[model samples]
Target: MRQLFGFLLLFATAAPLSAAEIHDDIDADTGWQVITAQAGQTKIRVVPAAGFNVFSIEHAGRELLKTPPALADLPGVSYGVPLLYPSPNRVRNAQFTFDGKTYHFDANDGTNFIHGLVHNVPWTVRRTEVDAHQAVIEAELVFAPGTKHYAAFPLEHTLRVTVTVRPEGVSWKYEVDNTHGKSKVPFGFALHPWILYQGERKNTFLTIPATQWMEAENLLPTGKLVDLEGTPFDARAAKSLEGFVIDDVYSGMQSDHPTVADFRDEGIQLSLDASDDFTHLVVYTPENKNWFCVENQTCSTDAHNLYQQGLKAESHLLVAEPGETLSGTVNYRIRDARGHKFSRWEKAIRKFEAQDRQHPPAAGGTLFVGSSSIRFWDLPKYFPDRPVVNHGFGGSQMIDSLYFADRIVLPYQPRTIVVYAGDNDIAGGQSPETVAKDFQRFARKIHAALPETKIVYIAIKPSLRRWNLYEQMAKANDLIAAFAETDERITYADIATPMLNEQGTPKPELFIKDGLHLSPAGYELWTSVIEPLLPRAN
Candidate 1:
């Protein structure tokens, strides 16, 4: 039997030419880097030497951020969204006592250490890529026990940061891991973003969702918390920064809550949503400078001194103990007053929510998710004795799992989960390596919250229609299989194997009429292979 074909590549505006791109370059003198990411009318540029922070964000040939003139000469932390590692703000006398040892930092901010060591240092660009949606760059910097980074901070740690620039917005993620094998390290972080607007202070409005402001002496918190009420610093709601000097550190954001600091000026709204890992917000509107800073912080200024003074109530510090890693995210989403193509998937996502509400699946089942193969699975016939929930959507990619994982998979709370994707991704021309990394990211997001749960990834299978991509699919499966070996919670089910015959060709009888989706016979083949990989139903 033969089936008709419908390829979306003909009429859809999603041309391969419109995809985003990232270019890596190096400076001649400083040996620094200039990484540029471009997508449609939206463009982003960064200097990895400058803490890998975004140096420019342009939309329709207009710069959205006001870049300082001395960007190349001045300290990076003073401009752009600087990666303030180790600590966010100023530390008194460039010194702090951690675990009964007084460590001294490089005194660049007069007598205090303004930003951590990586702001002016170099970082290695591990990976950079541009897909249909966004351009991403992953960079890392490490400090050894005898290096200057350890000389100042006295802790051996590594920081991996990733920056993503899409048409909708830009986001930055931080992962700080303790590398000393059995030791512990304490650290704090803040991303200092000085956003620029076109209008005057009175015309630009700023709002920060914070409840309390910490009173500080000489830029260090004095262990006193004052209510953010009745003062010029009360930016709980949108207010203009007119006629008042501004420099403040505020806390009291709810955990896991996204605290949005909205800045509207020149008919454009730049929304900075800091995750709960960031407990403090610093707003600096200097009377002399035209730009304003909306900083997301993880702790108070001079947190070590506050901790030494027994002010545990006001200080929030992060620790990297053995077998433990810490991560935080800051999403800077943008909304243009003019029309833009930002919410193309809103309808589909909304419909998904509506469907979930209308018919919710039972919790604590073996969850099957991803592309049409999983969607078209005859779960009852395959796994009749086990409890199973299938939430597979249309011909989806790896990112779709990340998009709807919280809504669908998280609610089920399955004892064991299985994902099948990357087929469409490879068919759409994404590299095998990129597909593997995307699957890794998806699994990490799940296990971050559900540590005890086991996750299984079904290797992208070969079908008759898309057999041209079988090699790439096999490579993707190989990479993911290797990654699964590194994580104890993940299991890689090599289902792509038996689907191929002895001649290394796809089994045509396994495919449906379209020669793409799986047939009942194909589902049977999967059942025979994947059942033994799953845990026995309790």
Candidate 2:
């Protein structure tokens, strides 16, 4: 039986996989296919289908991964690609012992047992025809007590795997039943798939609405939860996965249905909707690898230990009674954004514009908008003698100021407008020309609406840190000053000039540890610059 299983594995690994035989049902109520393979410039595409949306995983015009096409193909390999599993990388030891029994498993990374045994093993496939456009594949794997390497598990179980492929995307369903009469079983399971052929690493992004992350000690979960706020663990934004080496588990994920792992450059997006059972996700990106893995899981890596420690919740565990079964599903889709970029600036701009239209800026109060440096400023206390309205948001750019001008600048309708912005624009990748143009547009709009309001443009400060961009910032300040000079109502305030050291750069005393932002001394310098310009108190 062992020899037969070995022969079956060899055949499964070496069988000829047909790419051409894969039929395309484009008109069968499934969504549009956004090809990303060599033909599509590796972008994502989204199509709407009947009863569901079809998302295809493509790079250029080549298809890399898709849902199984039939119920009979339940564990079917994608284009005969090796179904990469357990954990893609090294597992510390090729054996994990539990309940006084040691189980020795196959090792791939010299240290870790990977992808579990199910991935490389072949299963009997039974296909069911559902019209010409749809089909279902059902595959089953039964493990008897004391079967070769699985002897440590010592429990009879039947695992049924189902795959449904339509024109839109693929859906996978797994049902596990304990056949051991009156005997309880202890086991852990996970699904692993490696997505490869991704284009430029810097251009690819992974987003998961996760609130907490699990820190690892040598790739083993530590059973501790860490907040995602203010850390690189936060993938709320589609940040570049380049230079990131992540092999961590994340729990407490936002219950947002259908979480997405979008790879725009590859024109592929893998979505997991295990909202009912799989609440945790593990994202793995090894340095210099061509692919990444987004594994939907019910628990962490060391779930058994976690459960023993009372760190695992009941929702994360899969327990079965006599004749009881556990089942769940994961769906994958593909989409293309057509080069449309996603940024915090764009969202902030849209929100500001909406608020501006609803409650236009008061026309003249001082507008202090920029990065964290500006937001930290206590406007009311700083300018107590003057009637000032604060419109400052931390970590904002000049473009944000322009987009949110009505909310931050124009609403106060004061006699003068003091503008403090631009630092974050430079950090956010805007050139001096871009920053100047945005500022110019904002000033023109304000002036057009309130001709009598005086415009005061504050100079972008040089931070003791982030000196690399100092020259470009200086150039930006110069352009702003030149632009302000073109109008009678516009005035330039050179706060940066006085704050600089004898060497004509920021002094360390004026900055915080990050160096890009300011210290109390920095705010004091700003106060000195504005104190003389404020109008007398009433």
Candidate 3:
């Protein structure tokens, strides 16, 4: 019955649960078991059945991290934990040439050589033991030479990862033994832990001790280290991970030592420690997402290629001799530092907000505002013929639109302001009336502040996934159009009408696989709709 339910869920979510549904025991005597234990002020346990993982820290029975459904299914499993050959974050064309030969690997998320081949592969469970105070589990994963999945790199390797849990914290140790006899194997490795937390990730505090940072031209490291001075990349202290966009790799760390990252707020305090072998850390903070990643890596993106380029030092490469093994560890601990974090987070938010508020949006160029979908849009390409200033944020509602109107929309003094919003507000469960009112408020704010500026409200797009809210969205559009009618300066651009299919629903071809967001075709449609309304190129 459990297997049936798991299989059903896999199809429903479109996310495979092969790793998550590994039960505690295989029938009566064939599988692994889930173990639980408590230590000190923290409670810890392991899933010996699935990768021998450890998880669920508690102080007085309260969860330290947000236990979402996806997380609960894989109780103690860590996602994207790298082994053997750590993949690069971004690769040119998702393929790299090594030793004058081209190698192709799986592109997990559109463009990057993610977590390597070992990710999602099952590891054989070896042993499991649990006491009232602690639980320890161990596992061994062997990759045979010339295996089809890993045929790109023909090297036999035996990888062993051990996980230990206690009330103090949970620790993971990885050991990779090169079984390919007598020949040096060039490979990369990294650990990507899917961290979850409650409330806003922007409220969290993070610190990485490094003397210098690496600069990237196109996701590939330039092998250069600039001093960490007056840049957002500086993580020398416990700074709030808010309002800063980062997807770069940092090098020249104090040591090839495990660095500590802490998040303290809302009655919870959590800390993560990476191993000494983990030299580089990639900090990924997407706009408005509830979670952020502080990935510990042994080398930078495309390390193998970088190695060939002689861009990376010989010391940075981990060349395991015949029968030799490479090893490392990572630890996560939870504690209570709510008061400190609350005050710190509040101050941080105020400081960042003030910085944003101080810089009011100028009214001279094209002003783009609203949600991440807009922010993430390549403005240069999207408005190739016009000068555009991007002001879109992720997960922002109409209220945020009004709030940041001055900083974002008003600053450009744009001859024409192109507004692309309301999608997130609707998705956030806001009523159409409420969204309409917010739009009205936004219009009023813009008009009052810069009466000469022309306001062009792009109609809310029809998304296939959010078709249930199509009627409400149309109603909101109607209200906005009605409001536009009252002002000569306000113009409504009817994009939704053209974007709809014959059935009067959102055209599926316009949406990406996610159904809610636009694909390249959708963007092209938007570009066509907006091109005419924009002022003639100066």
Candidate 4:
């Protein structure tokens, strides 16, 4: 299906556009397939013959991966990004019993088989394409009889990997097809990417978004989970890697937050967002080393043996029955710390676009856009009979709404638009003036593209947690309301004024336990204030 879409995109433009390009230069003995995107702002180098490994990923003239000094050293060096599959990290004694069969592997790492086969082997290039939006390279390896490593594992399966480079960032999709095999196959997948520190190594901040750590005695999980509270591997928040030496597997990964590496000195942030299949993460920050490894694994180390030992949940061993295709994606996004605010919301926007394609909302409906306040609102419950389209992405500010307006708002051609943002902007340290100015730009952009559309700006609400910022919120609301009065098509819904108590404090019952998000009563009150401004049900 992706290949078909790429083929369709090939004829999308009448004229040639230098958006993204794919080049294959294997005759030079380099055997590199390079894909460049965003007008050469980002480049990804893949060697199809060398395990289909993405050896180099350069962005903005900076190398993100740790590459060898010489090209000849690439094949032997363990640097760059390599996919560890079938079994990741290590297998106990290079042997594991799965189902009723026992298999053995080469002890590549001292009495244990580390990082399964196919990482350094040749793979067939299934497809490569360059479209206006992105460039893609798809490679596959058939792990059946006659294959190099098939005699050891003997699993008749096909592993397909697709790497895509776009303006936003790079994404990898790994898939395993076990349709031909009659037996249930057990496997694990992981990506070992040696990341180079962009600036000072000690100043590099890492956020793992994990709560539990796998207790390992010999570089392998011991089937025991430990809390990372006081351990040296507790990096749930953005913590500096100074004086920290860790090479451990972490569990209880939070799906909402991505594993991030913030280069504060370089003003660059590298984030890795993986699918739910990736429930475990391995962080390896060696002492006296300029590079660290943040590996996203589908299962814990020695998952097969651990699963056989009845530690199913902790092992996360994936079983593929007949005709099952196990697949997952991991996206690598790069953005500047000072700018590219909307890049973080690219996944959310893509999800919305995909939803639009499947079950599109009706045109000329009342559209709502904003931060978590709008995102958490039960639009259908509040306005049961009205036609409303909600595009509320949490953790968004006024500028995000304005930036994505063309994609989500204008395309809907809604008759009325309700916006409830700027709460997070002030909380995030942006000034009230900047928020109001952003809203002003948002209004102008909306009015320019959608002249007759009625825009109802929901005043930033007052919360108990941020009661101190009420003055700033009120100032922004006043600026927006005053601006709305100048425009006949705009309406400023002053929900903030009504949410306050007689003593001018935020009502405690109006907020949830967090004292920030709205309670049911608070949303009811907001509905009473903004429902009247919405388009009436016909």
lDDT (CA) for every model shown?
Answer: 0.73, 0.57, 0.61, 0.82
The numbered model that scores best in lDDT is 4
TM-score of each: 0.58, 0.47, 0.51, 0.61
Task: Give lDDT tens digits, candidate 1, residues 254-373.
Answer: 544444433333345677776787888888888867677878888888877787788766888777886677998888766644332324544544565566566665556688888888
Task: Report the number of backbone clashes for model 3.
Answer: 20
Residue 61 CA displacement from its true place in model 3, Å: 3.8
The order by descending lDDT is 4, 1, 3, 2
For residues 70-168, could you state the per-residue lDDT of candidate 4 as single tens digits? Answer: 444555228788888899898999999988789999898899999998887778888888886788888899988897778877988888999998756
- Pitting candidate 1 against candidate 3, the one with the higher lDDT is 1
Per-residue lDDT of candidate 2, residues 388-495 (tens digit): 655566776665565444334444455676777788778666678767866786777666546787777788888866678878888999999998888988888888
Number of clashing residue pairs, candidate 1: 0
Question: Worst lDDT window (10 residues) for model 2?
Answer: 34-43
What TM-score, to 2 decimals, does candidate 3 have?
Answer: 0.51
Candidate 1 accuracy as TM-score: 0.58
lDDT comparing candidate 1 with the true structure: 0.73
At residue 354, candidate 1 shows an lDDT of 63
Q: Could you tell me which 10 consecutive residues in candidate 1 have the lowest summed lDDT?
A: 1-10
